[model samples]
Target chain A: MDTFAKLQILSGAARYDVSCASSGSKREAPSCGTGNTSSSGICHSWADDGRCISLLKILLSNDCIYDCAYCVNRSTNPMERASFTAREVIEITLDFYRRNYIEGLFLSSAVMQSPDYTMESMVRVAEALRTEEQFGGYIHLKIIPGCSSELVRKAGLYADRISVNIELPSQASLQRLAPQKHKNAILEPMALIGREISTSLVERKVSRRAPQFAPAGQSTQMIIGASPENDFQILRLSQGLYKKMNLKRVYYSAYVPVTADNRLPVLASPPLLREHRLYQADWLLRFYGFSAEEILSEDAPHLDESFDPKTAWALRHPEFFPVEINRADFATLLRVPGIGVLSAKRIIAARRFSLITYEGMKKIGVVLKRAKYFITCSGRSFEKPDQPPALIRQQLLLSENREALVSAPSKQLVLPGFFA
Target chain B: MNQYLYDGTADGLLSAIAWILEEEPDPEKVMLRERMDTLFEEGFTIGTDATLAESLFFRLKQFAPDAAHTLYSFMLAEKEGMETSLLHYVSLAFKHGDQVKGYLTHPAVRDIVYIAKKAGRELHRMKGLLRFEKLRDGAYLAKMAPDYNIIHPLADYFSRRLRAQHWFIYDVKRRTAVRWNNGSLQFGTIEQFTTPAFSEDEKKVQALWQAFFKTIAIPERKNPRLQKSNMPMKYWKYLVEKQGE
Candidate 1:
C-alpha cells in the first residue's frame, strides 16, 4: 500500500487513544537542529470532535498479534491493516513539523512480531530523528508491553514524554478481554521508567551535561466504561499512579464500542459525561488540595452528573461555605466553586491594594453565579447566610438546568478530551 | 481638556505616559492617541523623542521590573480607547508606586491586565497556527494578519526555534516582515512583495499534510463551532489544509 493508505489505516486505528498533550518539557534547538519543544505545548489545530490536535498521532502499524477486545484492531477483527517503514514515518513527521502542522510526533504500534521487536522499530525511528536528522521537536513514544529494559531506556533518551497504557482498570477485566496480557508485564516497565527518570534527575544535578530522560515525565491512560470499575475505584487508582509511578498525567479514555463483544456492556453512547466528571475529580486531585477520599468517598461512589465535582464537594461540606473573600487565604478561596486557580490568585493579589467587593469580584473574573453561595465579599453574602444546604442545592440545580438549556439546545455538550 | 499623541510605538507611548504623569495633567480630561490625524486631528501630536522614551523605559524597569512585558503587550492591543485606558493605568501606577500590580480588582489595572492576557493568548496560539512554505530558493516564508500587532512577538518566538534556517514571517495587514537570515533577525517593511512560487518538494509535502488533515476529522462528532473557535476561520486562508477553496 501507498504512504497515504498506510496513514489512513494507522491513524484511524490510533484515534481511539486520546491523550494529546505535547507540553511540560523545554528542549531548545541543538547547534544544527531544525526544531525545539516549547515550555508550554501548542495546539496546531482542533479536530471536528473539538479535541486539540497537538501532535501527528499515528500508529506505526495496526496489525496486532494479540487481540484486546476493546480495541478496534483486535487480531480477530476484520479490518485493513498496514505499517509504515521507519523512514516513511520520519519523512511525514519532518514535513509536517517544517510546515508547523504539529507540535511533534506521537508514535505507537501493535504487538508486531513481538513486544520487543515492535518497541525496537519505534525506538529506531525516534533515534534516527534525534541523532541523524537532529530533530529536537517533542516526541511521545508509547512503550509496548514486555519490551526489553534497554529498548525502554533508549526511548526515554529521545522522547520528550513516554506512556504505557494500563488499558483496563483492573486485572480481572484484563484477563477476560486480553488473556495474553499480564499486569506484571505492564507494571514492570512502568517501574523501570520511573526509576530511570529519578536516576537521571539525580545524575543531572551532579553533572549538568548528563542527558535528560523523558523530561516531560511519563503518563498512562485507562479505558473507562469498558470494565465494571466505579469512579471511586478509578480515582483511587489514579491517586496511586500519581504517588507511586511519579506520573505527570493519567488520561481517562471513554470506551467507544467498535466491535460486538460479550464481555463489554452495550451502551447507546460513550460515557462522556461520566468521563468528564472523572476528569473534574482528577483535576481536583492534581491542582486543588483535594484527595480522592475528599472528592469521592465510599458512600458516594459516583460523581453527580448535574453538578461539577467541586460544587458537589462544596454542597456536601457546608461548614466550609461563606469563606470571606477579603480575609480568606488562597487555599480556602480555591475551594469555592467559581473561584479557579487564576481568580483565586487574583483575589489574593487585589486584596493588598483594596478590599474586594461583589462588583470587584466579578471584575476579577469570578463566577458569582456558582460562587455567591460559597463566598462572601466584604462580609456580604449573595444568598442568605443561614441558607440550608438542601435548599441551596435545589436552587443551584434549577439554575444549572436553565443554563444547560441555554448552552446546549438539545443535549449535553461533549468536550473533546478529559483532564484538559 | 488636554490631549497627548505620540508616534505609534512602545517607546513613544511610554514616553508620552511619563510626560503626562510627570506634568500631573487632569486625568479626567487628558487623552492619549497614536499619531493618527484621522482619529484625532485637534490633539497635540508629540514627535518621537528618543531621550524621553529611553528614560521612561528605564524608569519602568527600575520601578516594576516584572510588569514591563505586561505594559508592552497591553500597548500592542489594537482595541479602541485602549490608549486612554492605559494612560489612566500608568498614571495610577505612578501615584501608587510599584504596588500597582496588586490592584487587579481596580478598573484601570484590570483593563490593562485583560488586554495583556488577550494579546499573550493570541501570541501563544499563533506559535502553532502560523504555517511556513519553502520557496524556490529554499527560504521559508509565512504570512499572518493577526488582530494585534503581534509580528514582533512571533519574530522573537521563531528566532529561537528556527535559528539555523532562513525564514521570514510577514504581517500582511501591517505590511511588515520579521526576517531571520541564518541566525540574525531583522524587522522591516516591504511594499508590494509578491508571493514566491512553491518548490516541487514543498508542493508534494503540502499535499500530504492536507490529506492527513482531511482524514483526521472524526465524522461521529463534527463540531464546526468548536473548531472555528479554536482555529479561527480568519487564519484559514493561509493554511495548506484550507487552501484551494
Candidate 2:
C-alpha cells in the first residue's frame, strides 16, 4: 500500500486504544533534534469523536497471529492487512513531528508473527528514532503480552510511557473472550516495567546521568462493557493496580462491538455514558482521595445516570455538606461537587485576603449550581440541600447539561475502516 | 478630574500606572485621555518612559512576582476597556502589596485574572495550533492570527525546541513575525511577508496527516460539537486537517 493508504488503515486500526496523553515527560531536544515533550502534554488536534490527538497513534501492523474476538485485527477477521517498514515509520514520525502535527509516536501492533517478533519490531522503530534521529519527543510503546523480559526492558529504555492492555477485567472473562491472552502474561510485564521505572528514578537521584526507563511510568487499559464486570469490580481492580503495580493511569475504553461473537453481549451502541461516569469516578479515585468502595458499593454497583459521582457522594453524605467555604480545609473543599483542584486552591488563597461571599465563588470560577447546595460562604447556605433527599436529587438532575450528554442521539457514522 | 494617556504599549501603560499611583493624590479621579474631556480635567501624557516602567516593575516583583506576568499577559488582551480595568488592578496590587494575588474575589483583581487567564490559554493553544510548512529555501514558515499578542511569549519555547532549524513564526494580524535563525531569535515587523515555494515533501505529508486525522476518530462516537469546542471554528482557517471540514 502507499503511505496514505497505509496510514489510514493503521491509524484506523489503532483508534480504539484511547490513551492519548503525551504528558509526564520533560524530554528536551538533544543538540539538534526535531521535537520535545512538555510536562503538561499538548493536544495537537481534536478528532471528530472529540478525543484529543496528542500523538500520531498507529498500529505497526494490522496482521495478527492471535484471534482475539473483541479486536478489529483478530486473525479470523477478513480485512486487508498491511505493515509499515521501520524506515517508513521513522520517516512518518520525523515528518509529522517537524511539522508540529504530533508530539511523538504512539506505536502499537497486533501480534505480528509472535510476541518477541512484534516487540522487537516496535523497539527497532523507537531505538532508531532516539539514536539515529536524536528525537526527544514523547514515545509510548505497547508491550506485547508474553514478550520476553529482555525485550520488555529494552522498550522501557526508549519509551516515555509503556503499557500492556489487560483487555478484560477478570481472568474468566479473558479466557472466554480472548483465549490467547492470559492474566499473568499481561501483569508480569506490567510489574517488570513498574520496577524498572522506580529503580530508574532512584538511580537518577544518585546520579543525573542514569538511564531513564519509562520516566512517565506505566499505564494499562481495561475495555469496559466487553465482559460482564461491573463498575465496582473494575474500579476495585484499578485501585489494586494503582496500589500494587504502581500504575500511573488505568484507561477505561468503552467497548465498541465490531464482530458478531457468541461470547460477546450485543449492544445498540457503546456504553459511552458509562464510560464517562467511569472517568469521573476514576478522577475521584486518583485525585479526590476516594476509594472505590466509597464511590460505589457492591449493591449499588453502577454510577448514577443523572448526577456525577462527586455530587452523588455529596448527596449521600449530607453531613459533609453545608461546610463553610471560608474555613474548609483543602481536603474538605475537594469533596465539594463544583470545586476542582484549581478552584479549591483559589478559594483557600482568596480567603486569606478577604472572606469569600457567594458572589465571590462565581467570580473565582466555581460552578455554583452544584456547589451552592453543598457549601456556605460564611455559615449561611446559598442553596440548601433541603429536607427530602429525593427533592434534592430532582434539583441536582435538572442542573446538569442533559441534552449534550445524555440525550444527544448518536448518528450512524460511515466508518473508514468499515470498508475493510 | 485627572487624565493620563500612554502609547498603548506594555511599557507605556506601566509608566502611566506608576505615575498615577506615585504622583496623583486621588486614584479614582484618574481616567484615560481619549476616554474623557481633557479640556476640563488635568490631563498628563505619560510618554513611554522605560526607566519608570522598569523601576515600577522591579517594585511589583518584590511584592508579588506573578503580578508582573499577570499584567503583561493582560496587556495583550486588547479589549475595549482593558486599560481602565488594568488601572484598577494595578491600584489594588499596590494597595494590597504582597497580598494582592490572594484577593481573587476582589472585583478589580478578578477581572484582571480573567483576562490574564484568557491570554495565557491562547498562548498555550497557539504553541500547539501553530503549524509550520517547510519552505524551498530549507526554512520553516508558520502563520497565525491569534486573539492575543502571544507572538512574543512563543519566542523562548520554539527557540529551544526547534533550535537547529531556521524558522519564522508570522503573526499576520499584527503584521509582525519572530524569525528564528538556528539558536538566535529576532522579533520585528515585516510590512509584506510572502513565502517562496514549499519543499517537495510538504504536500505529501499534509495529505497523509489529513487522512490520519479522519481515520483516527471513532465512527461510533462522532461528536462535532465536542470537536468544535476543543478545536474551535476560529482556528479551522489554518489547520490542514480542517481543510475540507
Candidate 3:
C-alpha cells in the first residue's frame, strides 16, 4: 500500500495506544550519526482531548490474529488492514524527521502472522532506521507479547524506549476481555526487558561501549473502566509495576466502548475527566511524595470529581491543616490545598531572605481563597481553622459561583474587578 | 534641557530614561530626539551612555531576575505604552526595593504581564505543535516568527533531537534563520527567502501525515473551535504538517 493508505489504517489502529510520549530518552547525535535525540521534553502536538502526539505514532499493521473485543482493529472488526514494508516505514519516518513534522517514530504492530512475526517486523523497522538511514531520532517500539527475549533485547538496542501494553489490570479481566492473550505472555517480556535494562546500565557503568537498552525505560498502558477493576486495584498494579519492574509510567486509558457487546459498558464516550483525574493522582504519587495506598482506599475507589487529587487529599487530611507557611518544609508546603509546585518553590526561595507574611503569601502566588483555611503565615490566619469544613466548602463554592456569574458575560461585565 | 538620542532600542531608550532621572531635568522641557536636527535651540544633545545603559540592565536583572525576560519580550513586541509602563515600574522598583511583585498586581504592570504571559503561552504551545516539512535538498524546513524570542529557546531542543537531519527554523517576523546541518547550528538572516520544493518521497510522506492528521480526528469529538484555540489559524501557513493545497 502507498504511505497515505498505510498511515490511515496504522494510525487508526495505533490511536488506542495512549503511550505517545517521547520523553525520558536523552540520546544526543553521535559524532558520525545523522540525527540527535533531545533531553528536554519533546515537542508535542495535542489532539482535541489534550493528549500529546509528538512522534510519528503508527502501527506496522492492523491485521491482528487475536480478537480483543474492546479494540477497533480486532480480528473480528471489518476494518481495512495494511502493513508497511520496513523500507517504506523507514523512508516515511526519515522524511517526516527531515521536514520537522515529528521528533521521532512510535512504531507498533498487531499480531499479523504470529507474535514473533509481528515483533520481527517492528524490530526491522527500528533496525533499518538506526543502521541504514542512520536515524538518531527517538524510536519507541512496542514489544509484542510472547516475542522471544533475544528479539526484545534487539528492539531495546535500536529503539530509545519500548513498552508492552498490560491491556487489562487484572488476570481475570484479561481472561474475560482478551481470551487469546495471557497475563504471563505480557508480564514475562516486561520482566525480561526490565532485567535487560538494569544489566545494560550496570555494564555501561563498568565498560564504555555497552549498548544502550531502552534508556527512556519502559511504560505500559491499562484500559480503565473496562472490567470490574477498581482504582485501588489499578493503583496496586501501578505501584507493583513501579516497585518490581521499575516501569517509567503506567498510563491509564479510559475505556471508550467501540463494540456493542453486552460485556462492555455502553458508554457513548470515554470517561475523559476520570482519566484526567487518574493522571493528576498519578502525578501526586510520582512527584508530590504521595503513596498509591494513601491516594485511594477500598471504600474510596474513585477520585473526587470536583476537586483535584491534591486538594481532595488535603480536605480529607484536615488534621494536617493550617501548616505554618514560615516553617513548613517543601513537601509539607506542597501538600497544602491550593499551593502548586511553582508557589512551593517560590515560598522556599523567598523565605530564606525574609519571614513570609500573609501579604507575602499573596505575592508568592498562593491561591489564598482556597489556602486561607489551610495555612498560617507568620501566625496570622485570614480565616480561622475552627470553621466547619462544610462552611468552608460552602464559602469556597459561593466564591466560585460569584466568579462564574461575573465571568459568564465577560464583555458585558466591563468592570476590571469582575475578572479579579 | 537635555534631549538625547535614545537609539530606539531597549537599552538605548532605558539609558535615556536613566539620564533624565540622573540629570534632574524638567519633565515638561525634556523631549526625546532620534536625530541632531530634531533638537531645538534650548535643547542640549546628550548621547546615550553605553555604561549607564549596561548599569541599568544589570540593576533591572538583580531586581527582577524573571521579569527581565518578560521585559525584553514585551519590548521586542513593540507594544504601545510600554516605555511609560516600564518607566513607572522601574521608578516604583527604586522606592520598593525588589518588592516588584506587588507592582505586578497593579493595572499597568498587570497589562504588560498579561500580554507577556499570553505571548509566552502561545510560543510554548507552538513549540510542540510547530510542524516542519522536508524540502528537495534534504533540509528539514519549518518557518515561525513567534512574538517572543522563542526561536533560540526552541532551537536547543530541536537541534539536539534532530541532530542527524539538516534542518532550518526560519523566523518570518525577524527574517532570520536558525539552521543546523551536520550537528552544528548557526543563526543567519533569510530575507525574502522563497519556499523550497520537497522531494517526491518527502511529498508522499507529507501527504501521509496530512491523511493521518485528518483520520485521527474522532468525528464525534471533532471540535474545530478547540483545535483553533490550541493551534491558532495565524500559525497554519508555516506548519507544514497542517493540511494545505
Candidate 4:
C-alpha cells in the first residue's frame, strides 16, 4: 500500500490512545539539523474532536497478537492491518517535522511478532531520527507491555516522554477483559522507567552533559467506564501513580465501545462529562493541593454532576465559605470555587498592591458570579454568606445556566430566572 | 481636541508619548498621523526620534522591565485607540513602578496587559500554524496573514529551528517576508512574487498529512465548535489539512 493509505489505517487505529501532550521537554536544536522542542508545546491543529494535535500520534502498525476485548485492534477483530517500514516511518517524521505539521512523532505499535520485536522496530525509528537526521524534535514512544528492560532502557534514551498504558484500573478488570496482559507486565516496565527517569534527573543535576533519559518523565492512561471502577477508585489509583511512580500525567479516557464484548458494559455514549469531571478532580489533586479522599468519600463515590468538584467541595464544607479574599493565603484562595491557579496568584499579588474589592475581583480574573456566593471582600460578604448550602448550590447552578444561555445566544431556547 | 499624532511605528508611538509627558500634557487624542486629518483641531505629528524613544523606554525598563516588555508587545498589537492605552499604561507604570502590571483593577493597566497577552499569544500560535512547502530549489516557503504583526519573532524562531535549510516566511497581509538562506537572514518585501515550482515530494507529503489529519479525528466525538474556537476559521485559508473543509 502507499504511505497515504498506510497512514490512514495506522492513525485511525491509534486514535484510541488519548495521550496528546508534547510539552515538558526543551530539546535544543542540533547545530545544523531540523526542528526543536519547546518547554511549552505547540498544537499544529485541533482535531474535530477538540483534542490538540501536537504530535503525529500514530502506530507503526496495528496488527495485534493479543485479544484485548476493549481495544478496536484486538487480534480477533476484522480490520485493516498495515505497518510502515522503519525507513518509511523516519521519512514521514522528518517531512512532517520540517513542514511544521507536528511537534514530533508519537509512535506506538501492537505486539507485532512479539513485544521485543515491536519495541526494537520503534527504537530504530527513534534512534535514526536522533542519529542520522540529528532530529531534536519531541518523540513519545508507547512502550509495549512485557517488553524487556534492556529495550525499555534504550527507548528512554531517545524518547523525551514514554508511556506504558495501564489500560484497566484494577487487576480483576485486566483478568476479565484482557486475559493476555498481566498486571506485572505493565507495572514492571513502569517501575523500570520511573527509576531510570529519576536516576537521569539526578545525573543531569550533577553534570549538564549527562544523557537525559525521558526528560519529560512518564505518564499512563486508564480507560474510564470500561470496567466497574468508580471515580473514587480511579482517582485513588491516579494519586498513587503520581506519588509513587512519579508520573508526569495520568490521562483518563472515557471508554468508547468498539468491540462487541460480553465483558464490557453497554453505554449509549462515551461518559465524556464524567471524564471531564475526573480531569477537574485530577487537576485539584495535582495543583490545588486536594487529595483523593478529600475530594470524594466512600459514601459519595461519584462526583456531583450539577457542579464541578471544587464547587461541590465548597458547598459541602459550608463553614469554609465567606473566605476573606484579601486575607486568605494562596492555598486557601485556591480552594475557592471560582479562583484558579492563575487568578489565585493574581489575587495574592494584586492584593499586596491594593485592597481587593468586589469589582476588582472581576478585574483580576475571578469568576465573581460563582465566587460572590462563597467569598467575602474586606469582611463584607456578597449576600451575608449565611445562606444554606442548598440555596447556594441552586444560585451557583442558576448563574452557570445563565452563562450557558448567554454564550450560545444563537440557540433560541431560554432558561427562566435569567433576568432575576 | 488636543491631538498628538505620530507615525505608526513603536518608536513613533513612544516619541509621541514622550511629547505628551514633557511638551503636550493631557492630549485628548493620541493617534496615527494618517487618522489625524479627520479630527484635526490642534495637533502635532511628533517626528519619531529614536534617541527620545530609547530614553523613555530606558526609564520604563529601569522602573519595571516586565512592564517595558508588555509595552513592546502592546505596540505590536497596533489596535485602534492603542496609543491612548499605551499613554495611560506608561504614565501609570512610571507612577507605580513594577506594581503597575499586577494592578489589574486600573483600566489603563488592565487594557494594556490584555492586549499585550492577546498579541503575544498570536506570535506563539503562528509558530505552529506556519506551513512550509519546499520549492524546487529545496528552499521552503510559508505564507501567513496573522492577526498581529508576529512575523519578526516568528522568523527569528524558525531561523534557528530550520537553520540547515533555506526558507522564507511571508506575511501576506503586511506585504513583507523574512528569508533565511541556510544560515544568514534577510528581511524585505516581495512585491511581485508568485507560486514557484515545488519540489517533487511536496505534494506527496501534503497529501499524507491531509490524510493523517482526517483519520486522527474520532468520529464519535466531533466537536467542530471547539475545533473552530482553537484554530479559527480565519486561519483555515492557508492550512493544507483544512483544504476540503
Candidate 5:
C-alpha cells in the first residue's frame, strides 16, 4: 500500500473493466528497446466520459473474496482495499513511464486472496514488467478467471493484450448477475488465450520472441443494460464472439446502475443510447457487411432510436433499395445508408475515372441526403424512386426533421433529421 | 517563360512536382512561387534546378519505389488544381510502369488520401482529446495546432504518459515544442510563449472534468447532433476538459 494508495485502491477496483483498447498491437520499436507498439494502439487519452485515460488504468488489488453483485470491489462494497508490491507496480509504471505520465499498464484484479492468489499477483506484474523493468511499454493483462494454463501462458509472455471479462451476456445472465463468475470459469481462460494466440501464429515458435502472442488481440466486456439480455441476445453473443472466440473486441458496457440490487434494472442512466446503438450494430457487424440476422430480430430487440444502424437497416430492407451509384459492388456500395468505409472506398475509387453522377455522388462523398432515396444514377432519381415504403419512411422522417431544425440555431428541434 | 521558384518546402513541393514532370510546363506558364525571392519580371529563375530536382527525383525513384514517400507527401499537400493533378498523376506514372500501383486507387490519388486521412483523424483526436493542466511551477502544459503531421504521431502517445512529468507539447500550428523533462525529449521553436497560470488544483480538475462532461450527456442522448458528429466545433477551442456547462 502506497504508490498513491495503490493507485486509489487499484484504480477504484479497475473501473469495472471496460477494456479500454490500446488496440491490436504490432510491437516494433525495439531496434534497441526502450518501447513502442503503436500501429494504432497505445495513445488512448479520452476521459470526459468517453474514458480511455491513456493507460495507468490500474488494479492489482481490490481485496475481494467474491461477492460479485455487480462489483464495486464486491465483498459487500465498502470500498477502500489496496495492494501493489510487484515492486510497487514496477515503481508506479517506471514513475509513470518516466514522467510523461503513461502509455501503458491497464492491469486488473479482485479475486485477491485466491484464484491462484489472484493469478499469482497478476503474474508478478507481468514478470516484473518483463524481466525486471525492461518494460517495453503497452501491457493490458487481465486473464484471471480460473487462472492457470501456465498463468494464461505467463500472461502471453509479458502482455501486449489479453482480456477475459465475458461478464454478463448470458449463461442466464451469468447465473443471475455474476454469481461468483463461472461459465467454465469465464470460458476456459478464453479458450486458453485463444489457443495460445493461435499456436504462436501457426508454429513459427521462436522462443522469447513470444512477445507477439497477444499482439493486441482478445477483447471482451458485455454488461449492457445488465441481465435480461436482448439486442437480439446481445448480437447473438456477438455472433459467437466473432465466429468462435477469435475476438478482437466485444466491449458494450452501459449498465451503470451502480448498486441497489434486487436483481438489477431500476435504471436511470446507462442505456447510453443503448450503448450507442450497440456500437452502431458493432460497426455494421465489423465494417458494414452486416449480419447477426441482418442487424436484429426476435421481435426487433431494440435499436431504431430513429434511423442509424445503417439507417435502420436501410428502412427495413426496402428490397435493398435503389442501389445503383453507377453500378454498385463493394458489397453493394456498403449497403447504401450514408455509405462509409471511407465512403465505400470512395465509391470504388470514383467509379474508375468517372460516370458516377447524382452530381458524381455529391463529388464522391455520398450521403446525398441519405443516399438520395437509396440510389440510382444514369437512370436518375435523387428523390422519388417508387416512394411508399410508408411514404419513404415519412419522407425520410421529414428530412430528419428538416435537418434537426437546421442544426440547433438555439436548440429545441430535438433529433429531427435524425442524423440526416 | 519557364519561371520556377517552388521552396514552400516538402523539398520545395518535390521540386515543383519534379519540374512539371520533366519540363513540359505551359499549364499557362506554370507559376507556383512560395519564395526564393518570387522571380518573374520576364522570367528565367529556375534555381530549384538542383540538377533538375535530381532528375525528377531519379524518375520518381525509378517509377514508384513503393510510392516514393507517398508521392513525396502528396506533392507537399497539393491544392489549387495541383499542377493539373500532378500532371495527370505523372502522366499515369509514365504509362503504367509498375502498373503504377493501380494509380493508388485514383480519384486524383483518393482526393489526397481523403485530405490526409481527415487531417490524420483530427490529429489523432487532438492527441487523445488534449487536456493539460497543473501549472504553479509543476509545469505540465499543452497547446495544439493540429490540422496534421499530428506532431510526430502525437509524440508517441504523449511521451509514454508524460514520463515522470515536466511537460510542454505546444504545436500551435508548427511553432513547435515537444519538451518533456529529466527523462528527456527536446525539439524547439516555441519562441515567445505564455499561457501558464492555472493551479487551484488545476481549476478543480477543470471543474471536475466539466462535471464529468455534464454528467455523461444523455439528455435522452441529447445529440448536439451526435455530439457534433463525434466532437467537432473545430475541437471546441483546445477542449480544456470540454469547457462544458
Candidate 6:
C-alpha cells in the first residue's frame, strides 16, 4: 500500500490511545536538523473532538498477534491492516516536520511477530532520525510489554518520552480480557525506565554534557469503565504509580466499546462524564495538594458529577471555610473553591501591598461565584454569616444550573488559561 | 490642552514617553497618540530622534528588563488607544521600580499586561499554525495575516528551528514577507509577487494531512464548541487542513 493509504489506517487505529501531550523535554535543534522541541508543546490544531494534535500520533502497523477486547485493532477484529517500513516512517516524519505539520512523531506498533522485534523496528526509526538525520524533535515511543531491557534502554536514548500502557487497571481484568499480557510485563519496563531517568538526572547534574535518557520522562494510560474498578481503586492505583513509578502523566481513556465481548459490560456510550470527573480528581491529586484518599474514599467510590472535585471537597469540609483572603497563606488560599494554582499565587503576591477585598479578589483571577461561600474579605464574609453547609450546597447547585444556562447560549468551552 | 503625536513605533513611543517624563504632562491636559490629523487647537508632532530613544531604552532596561520587554511586546499589538495605556504602564514602572512586576492589581499595569499576553499568545500559536509548502523554486513558502507585527519576533525562532532550510513567511495582510536563506533573514515587501504553484509532492502531502485530520476526530466525542474555542474560526482560512473543507 502507498504511504498515504497506510497513514489513514494506522492513524485511525492509533486514535484509541489519547495521550496527546508533546511538552515535557526541551530538545534544541542540532545544526543539521530541521525541527526543535519547545518548552511548552504547541497545539497546532484541535480536532473536532477537541483533542490537541500536538504530535503526529500514529502507529507503525495495525496487525497484531494479541487480542485485547477493548482495543479496536485487536487481531480478531476484521479490518484493513498495514505497516510502514522504517525508512518510510523516517521520511514521512521529516517531511511533516519541515512543513510544521507536527511537533514530532509518536510511533507505536502492535505485537508483530514478537515484542522484541516490534520494538526493534520502532527503535530503528528513532535511531535513524536521531543518529543519521540528526533530528532533535520530540519523539514519543510506546514500549511493547515484555520487551528486553536492552531494547528499552536504546529506545530511551533516542526518544524524548516513552510510555508503557497499563491497559487494564487490575490483573483480573487483564486476565479476563487480554490473557497474553500481564501486570509484571508492563511494570518491569516502567520500573527500569524510572531508574534510568533518575540516574541520568544525577549524571547530568554532575557533568553538564552527560547524555540525556528520556528527558521528558515516562507516562502511562489506563482504560476507564472497561473493568469493575471504581474511582477509589483507580485513584489509589494512579497515586501509587505517581509516587512509586514517578510517571509524568496517567491518561484515562474512557472505554469506547468496539467489539462484542461477553466479558465487557454493555454500554450505550463512552463514560465521558466519569472520565472528566476522574481528570478533575487527578488534577487535585497532582496540583491541589489533595491525597487520593481525600478525593475519594471506599464509601464514596464515585466523584460528584454535579460539581468539580475541588468544590465537592470544599462542601464536605465546612471547617475549612471562610479563609481570610488577606491573611490566609498560600496553601490555605489554594483550598478555596475556584482558586487555582495560578490565582492562588497571584493573591499571595498582590496581598503583600494591600489587603485583598472581595472585589479585589475578583480582579486577581478568583472565580467569585464559587469562592464567595468559602472566603472572607478583610474579616467580612462575602456570603451570609453562619450559613449551613447543606444550604450552601443547595444554593451552589442552583447557581450551577443557572450558570450553565447562561453559558449554554454562548456554548463557550473555556480554553485553558494562557498564564502558564 | 497639548497633544503630542509621534510615529507609531516602539522607539518613537519610547521617545514620547521620555519627553513626558521630563515634562510631567497631566493626563487631562496632555494627549499622546500615533501620527494622525488632530482637530485640537494646539498639537506638537515629535520627530524620531535616535539618540534620545536609545538613551531612554537603555534607561528603562536598566530599571527593569522584564518591564521593557513587556512594553515591547505590547507595542507589537495592532490595537487603538494603546498609546495612553503604554504611557500609564511605563510611568508606573518608573515610579515603582521592580515592584511593578507583581502589581497586577494596578489597572494600568493590568491593561498593558493583558495586551502583551494577547500578542504573546498569537506568536506562540503561529509557531504551530504556520504551514509551509514546497514551491517549484525549491523554496518553502508560508502565508499568514496575524493581528500583530510578529514576523520579526518569530524570525529568531524559525532561524533556530529550521536553520538549514530556505523558507519565507509572507504576511498577506501587511503586504510584506520575511525570507530566511543561508542562516540569514531579510524583511522586505513583495509588491508584485503572486502565490507560487505548490509542487505535486507538496500537494499530495497536504492532502494526506487533511485526510488524517478528518479521520482522527472521534465521532462519539465531537465537541465543535471546544474545538472552535481553542482554534478560532478566524485562523481557519490559512490552515491547510481546514481549507476547502
Choose the strongest candidate by lDDT: 4
- Extract clashing residue pairs from model 3: A34-B164, A35-B164, A36-B161, A36-B163, A99-B132, A99-B133, A99-B134, A100-B132
lDDT of each: 0.84, 0.84, 0.73, 0.86, 0.65, 0.85
Q: Which candidate order results from sorting by DockQ in descending order?
A: 2, 6, 4, 1, 3, 5
Q: What are the candidates' individual DockQ scores?
A: 0.62, 0.70, 0.31, 0.65, 0.03, 0.68
Q: What proportion of the real contacts between chains A and B does each prediction keep?
A: 0.66, 0.79, 0.42, 0.75, 0.04, 0.75
For DockQ, the strongest prediction is 2
Task: Please identify which of the two predictions, 2 or 3, would achieve the higher TM-score against the true structure.
Answer: 2
Q: Candidates sorted by lDDT, descending order?
A: 4, 6, 2, 1, 3, 5
Q: What would you estimate as the lDDT of candidate 6?
A: 0.85
lDDT of 1 by residue, A1-420 (tens): 988788878887888777788888889887787789886778887776766888898999988999888988899999998999999999999888877889899999988989999999999999999999999898999999899999999999999999999998899999998888899999999999999999999999999999999998999999889899889999999999989989988888788898899989998888877888888888889888899999888988988988889999999899887899999888998899977887888888888878889888887787789888887778798888868889989999999889777886322233333233
With candidate 2 superimposed using the best TM-score fit, by how many Å does residue B67's alpha carbon deviate from the native? 1.9
Measured on C-alpha atoms, candidate 1 has an lDDT of 0.84
A143-236 in candidate 5: lDDT tens per residue?
8787668888888877878888888887877877677778998888887888888888766565645446776778878777767777887887
Q: For residues A1-420, what per-residue lDDT tens digits would candidate 6 score against the true structure? A: 998899899988888877777887888888867788887777778888887787888899989999988888889999999998988888888888888888899999988999999999999999999999989888999999989999999999999899999998899999999999999999999999999999999999999799899998898999999999999999999999999999988888888888888889999988887888888788788888889998888899888988888899988899888888888888888888888888888888787667887777776667788888888888899789778889889999999789778786332122232211
**What DockQ class does candidate 3 belong to?**
acceptable
On TM-score, the stronger of 1 and 5 is 1
Q: lDDT by residue for model 3 over A320-348, one digit each (tens)?
A: 87789889999998888778776887788
Docking class of 6: medium
The better-scoring model by lDDT among 2 and 5 is 2
lDDT of 2 by residue, A1-420 (tens): 788889989999999997888888888889777778888888888898987888999999999999998999999999989999999999999888877889899999999989999999999999999999999898999999999999999999999999999999999999998899999999999999888899999999999999999988888888989888898999999999998999988888888998778888899989888888888888788888999999999899988877789988888897777778989899999998888888888888888877888788887777787777778777878765454557777777765556448766443221111011
True contacts kept of 3: 0.42
- Can you tell me the DockQ of model 6? 0.68
The TM-score leader among the candidates is 6
- The 10-residue segment of model 5 chain A with minimum total lDDT is A411-420
Error at B217, model 2, angstroms: 0.6
